[model samples]
Target: MPELRTERLLLRAWQPADLAPWAAMNADPEVRRYFPEVLTREQSEASVARFQADLDERGWGWWAVEVRATGEFIGFTGLDPVDEDMPFTGVEAGWRLTRSAWGHGYATEAARAALTFGFTTLGLPEIVAVTTATNLRSQAVMRRLGMACDPADDFDDPDVPDGPLRRCVVYRISAGTALS
Candidate 1:
């Protein structure tokens, strides 16, 4: 896949070295707070393997994000095709970063680049972002990306048990929309 450069980050394919930090991040309570559950090292590796396979086959999926200046593998931000069983199905923009990387604008910066690639490079008509109703941080990033929310689009995630995480909200942005 192609590498995307933002002001301070590089969105690129996953490397062998990213596994350790990626696993550590997935295991972090703060980082995984919004997720349904913390991922084990084995599960994290499996996730990486799945992402790598997707990128290898489709040339695009969740790309590993690195700091340009320090070359640190902070996290990942990219697009993924929503599962067919989901309430809404389409390309979704998502991000997950290490705890230390929080409070920085990395997620928004890298996500914008992914959205750009999705619209311009892939010619996708629209992209959606889904998060638990309580995940205000991610919802803020979606707003910054010019995604609009419609309460009617909200749905309970079938994969999540009936609880706070199950009540998810979706934000969407169409092609040609101006991004913040």
Candidate 2:
């Protein structure tokens, strides 16, 4: 799989060393605030397995993100086919970071790299980002990556239980408007 590098972060394939910190991040309440619930170690490991398989197959998918400076595993950011169960279909850009990594523009930086790969490398015509309506931090990062929100594209995710995370918002960026 192709490894992506930004000024301060690396978007690379998963390593055995990443498992511990990845589980810790998934178990973190703050880190999982937008999701249905925190994940168990088994769930986290299974997710890594799935992500790695996709990467191996297509050469691109969710990547383990790390700080290039200290080699600290921060989180993940990359492109994935929108879940088959979703109301929509297209590639989506996403990122998750450890709580300590927030407010540092790393999400935007890493996401921008993902978006670039989607638009240029994969020749995708558009990429969308979906998040809970309440996840303003991720929305902000989407906006920074030049993605625009259209209320018409928003929908309540059928998979999420009726709650704070059910209402979803989607931000979109077409290849034409993508920023390098």
Candidate 3:
């Protein structure tokens, strides 16, 4: 898989060493707050395996994000195919970081790299991001990346069981609208 470098983070292929930390990130209630539930270690490991497979086959997917200077596995940031069951169809940009990695602009920086790749190298016309409507943290990151939300795009996620998280907002940025 191709590796992406920013000012500090490296978006690269998942390594065996990243597994434990990735699992921890998945299991953290705070980190998983926007999702339905925290993941088990086995589920986390399976996610890494799937991420690696996507990277190996497509040359891009959710990447293990590491701090360049310290080589610490903080989390993941990259492009993913929007869930097939969603009302929309397109690539999506996403990020998840360890609590320690929050508030450092890492998500924005790393996600910018991912969006750049989707718009330029992959030639995708547009990329979208979805999060629970109440997930202001991620919504803020989307805004930082110059993505805009159309109220009309909001919808109840078909895949989510009944809960607060079912209502989601979709933020979109076309190639022409993406930041340089």
Q: Which candidate is the best by lDDT?
A: 3
Give stretches of model 1 more than 4 Å off: none
Which stretches in model 2 have alpha-carbon errors above 4 Å? none
Taking the tens digit of each residue's C-alpha lDDT, what string does model 1 give over 1-180? Answer: 688999999999899999999999998988999878999999999999999999989999999999999999999999999999898889999999998898899999999999999998999999999999999999999998999999999998888888778899999999978433
Query: If both were scored by TM-score, which would come out higher, candidate 1 or candidate 3?
Result: 3
**Candidate 1 — what's its lDDT?**
0.93
Model 1 CA lDDT for position 96: 92
The deviation in Å at residue 147 for candidate 1 is 0.5
lDDT scores for all predictions? 0.93, 0.94, 0.95
* Per-residue accuracy of model 3 over 1-180 as CA lDDT, tens digit each: 689999898999999999999999999999999999999999999999999999999999999999999999999999999888889999999999999999999999999999999988999999999899999999999999999999999999988998899999999999998845
After superposition, the stretches of candidate 3 with alpha carbons farther than 4 Å from their true spots are: none
The positional error of residue 172 in candidate 3, measured at the CA in angstroms, is 0.3
What is the lDDT, from 0 to 100, of the residue 13 in candidate 1? Answer: 88
Residues 1-180, candidate 2: write the lDDT tens digits.
899999999999999999999999999999999999999999999999999999999999999999999999999999999989888899999999999999999999999999999888999999999999999999999998899999998899998999989999999999999843
What is the lDDT for 172 in model 1?
Answer: 95
Model 1 worst lDDT run, 10 consecutive residues: 171-180
lDDT at 130, model 1: 93
